[model samples]
Target: MSENNTRVIVITSGKGGVGKTTTTANIGVALANMGEKVALIDADIGLRNLDLALGLENRIVYDIVDVVEGRAKLRQAMIKHKQSQNLALLPAAQTRDKSAVNPAQMRQLIEEIRAEGYTYIIIDCPAGIEQGFRNATAGATEAIVVTNPEMSSVRDADRIIGLLEAQDLRNPYLIVNRLRPKMVKSQDMLAVEDVQEVLGSNVKLLGIIPEDEVIITSTNKGEPASATEGSLAGQAYRNIARRLRGEEVPFLDLEERSGFFTRLKGLFGNKK
Candidate 1:
């Protein structure tokens, strides 16, 4: 369709447990908090969990399926976030499978959301490059591929990036989630440079999110970490949102926090 003021971004990961849903929720929350009208779509359908991640599971009366089937209007299906008035969610149906909606329908639904004047529409794509992936990416003007700092995750991300490029989608940015600086420092895990080397030079690095307890606690509490201050993972997500808004922001110093404590200990002659 025609390009407009709104930008539809599909957050995808070829492999599961790479934090695509979490990234979508936090980025939406961050953008909304910045006064941008943002819409988050759960495109996982029967396996939908974006609502739970954003603490809006109980608030979903209607979903994207309802709107697609003409059972509910777009406005009626969107659930506004309690954390930010500018952020809303268009949840997926819990009972319906991925095949329940097709690519064209997804494109139309996203177009409708964009027409409603949202500055950003982020779609949480299901894991793997299948029907769900196709449906989730139908209307995407941009793509954010989330991956962990490992061989399998990076391999899958490269595959997904190839798919997006084949479909002529915009250059997909990479978000390396769950990176542990200690492991990398100990040479027990793949470093960020290694991941970039394997993924190729054309791929753009968006942001890196460190492994943090706040993410787990926030997930359990059904609250997005982005709305919680002093959360390292949340701050990393907010940085990604700012970068997406075309602002110059540095990639997070994943080792800074730990190193700071080490330096303080040495200053007091308590080095271990």
Candidate 2:
């Protein structure tokens, strides 16, 4: 198969439960909402949750495995979201393992999936450095590595960056998830800059996802946090989508700025 003019991206995390799938779903929805043809593929295989997070789990009749095996056509595996007209899902098969498919198979699948006019193809990869990860990044035009603001998570993200760099996935972007400005200011937790201090040199800072309860609540409700009104994290993801499209959106308010009162205090020799 031949490639199209579509941008295929892989959403990956070195560690588990670091919001890779959530990022995949939200960013996919945000892009589709912006009138782009998007398709979210569950490349996690057996342990797939991309469909559930997207609230289209029950709608899956075919999967990536099914497509590779030719049990059904590629179109038959895609489940369109009733809410987002341009957004469709290619779920993972629970009955299959990661070994069921390979990188070539994935490349072929995405090439065909893009034929349906999908402008953006986002693959939700499985955790760990295995064949699943290899297949997730087979022919990606770019990569978005997601990690939380923590030592363990950051460490894993660094390892992931190393692998991607070795693969030469140029211009891969990083998204610092669950950032808590208060904890960072108090020196209790890692800040967005801290994570960037480690991995940002290699990967561009795509966006910062703050630690918000709205994300959890929306996930349980089978809705993307970005869809909720005044959702900070949701808005952040939407901005990320726009940025991905080469749009220039202002930076979000992740940290509190120096107010007039704070500046006055500093000028009066009462800094802090």
Candidate 3:
């Protein structure tokens, strides 16, 4: 791919435990599965986990820090995905802190990867708005903010969107992860529209990933859920990848499997 066709996207969430890393892994894999050349960068520094998420931990001989420090070449630091030849991962240094690299170095690194002809470069940003976040967003042409359905996550996401806009990264897409339809039906969780209302209208809803056990199981096996079959969350990530490719794919209907009214009726009937 030419430099003009390359998209450098940063996946970020202001709060931790919001599936930002997982989103990066799955989305990279999903895009690669669709025949797009993808490069994933773990910009978390000391908290690096993208390598493990992609099951390339054991194969990592060099990391991003090594490349920036002039100890390793970019190609030497990148570990290719086992399943998809088009996918690769450039891991962070577990021994180093966020201050180890600067925004300029990150931009240079991304340019090197772009020169390698990658169609998409996905950066898994560290949680919080710190130097790590700045380093991750330095060369990103696009951004994806990952958040949950809770108030805390939404509030943090709003802040992140503002930060991105301040950096001239406007109209960042939103991905609401770990949504529970049953809880939403019982008025316990925020609905998609409710979350969007709090975030205002500019942030477009890219995808809605229902809470799935397969995510945990797949991660435990060091494999991303999107690379597996028969998983709702996996399919959701795939659909998001297609949408990223400019395809007009519809969002998944999360409540179709178990009707909320039927479950409510069953609960009341059992109480009699």
* TM-score of model 1 (CA atoms): 0.93
Better lDDT candidate (1, 3):
3
Q: Model-by-model lDDT, in order?
A: 0.87, 0.85, 0.91
Q: After superposition, how far is residue 209 of candidate 3 from its true place, in Å?
A: 0.5
RMSD of each: 4.6, 6.3, 5.8
- Tens-place lDDT per residue, model 2, 47-160, is 989888889988889888989999989889999997898999999999889988898998888878878778999999899998888988886879999999898888998888
lDDT of 1 at 236: 84
Better of 1 and 3 by TM-score: 3
* Model 1 pairs in collision: none
Better of 1 and 2 by lDDT: 1
Global fold similarity of model 2 (TM-score): 0.91
Best candidate according to TM-score? 3
On TM-score, the stronger of 2 and 3 is 3
Each candidate's number of clashing pairs is: 0, 0, 0
Off by over 4 Å in 2: 1-3, 256-272
**Per-prediction TM-score to the true structure, in the order listed:** 0.93, 0.91, 0.94
Residue 1 of model 3, lDDT score: 60
Error of 3 at 57 (Å): 0.8
